[model samples]
Target: MTVTAPEMANGIFGGVFNLNYSGDKNRLIWHRHWLVCISCGAYAGVGCFLFAPRGLMYGFVASLFTSCCSIWADYVHIEDPQHLAHLVDRWAAFHFFFVLVCECAYVLHMPIWYLTMTLCLALALFSLSRSSRSRQSWVLLHSAWHVLPMGLLLLPGLIS
Candidate 1:
């Protein structure tokens, strides 16, 4: 059965939530990686109560971006935390491309709020490249990195 947010409402640790995920952040494998993302998409596509003709596009680009970043990291090395260091190396690239897709998807529609949030998310992403020393800071920013895009794509009230 397709999982729903309500079913896992207790949290990620809920029993029903472990369909096929590794649950390891340091190294998120395919099953978990895809489960989390596809679940995210399912939520956005269903729960958002918005017109999401572009949702699949956003999801496709997201997956592609991650794959590309994974390759880039394996081949290259960088020390910078807030720059190409992530794409040249880690998860930051994942967030960047996600925001990139989110940003581009709006070029045609460009609603007032969408444009505003788009800029906000873009700024948040750019700031991610600046690097942070505080682990808490990174945590907050990283969570926002994922939550904001999902919110933009899914939480909007009646997007069309």
Candidate 2:
């Protein structure tokens, strides 16, 4: 019984896309979204390492928090993930975004930070509120929550 990479990945991540999940809707959605969220955090860490080496610690912390949350989801099959996931999500996001804001603190006069914050908040709230209504919407919006900050955070470094 050779467990190949694909098999291993499937075993660990299979629940991510399988929305049906024994006719339980919400459970699988959060699990899947958190997987994407962790990926985003990991990518952000890599981006920090490449561009803003100094922020690698912050990125790592953010990724680790989300990873723990996701791992917990995988560890236990639960009816609802919202309770713990929300707390972990907020903590992880706060650390990531707070570091981002501080890094760009010198550019306080710029509107990009304000705009990014507003958009992130809006997406987070919208995705959370509508999570139960539509899995697709929540997935997309939640993914945006992960990617948007990474893009903005790394853009200036890439451009300059």
TM-score of each: 0.38, 0.51
Lowest summed lDDT window (length 10), candidate 1: 26-35
Off by over 4 Å in 1: 1-59, 62-64, 67-85, 88-113, 125-131, 157-160
TM-score: model 1 vs. ground truth: 0.38
RMSD of 2: 13.5
Clash counts for the predictions, in order = 2, 0
- Residue-level lDDT of model 2, residues 1-160, one tens digit each, is 7876655543443322222233244565444445454545543453345324654455455555654554444323333544554445445554645654554554323356554775566455434533445666656655555556555555555676
Off by over 4 Å in 2: 1-38, 50-52, 55-79, 82-85, 107-132
Per-residue accuracy of model 1 over 1-160 as CA lDDT, tens digit each: 7768655642432221222322233232112122223322322332223333545455445545554554333223222223353434235343644454555465434465765675567456435622444544544544454446645655445454
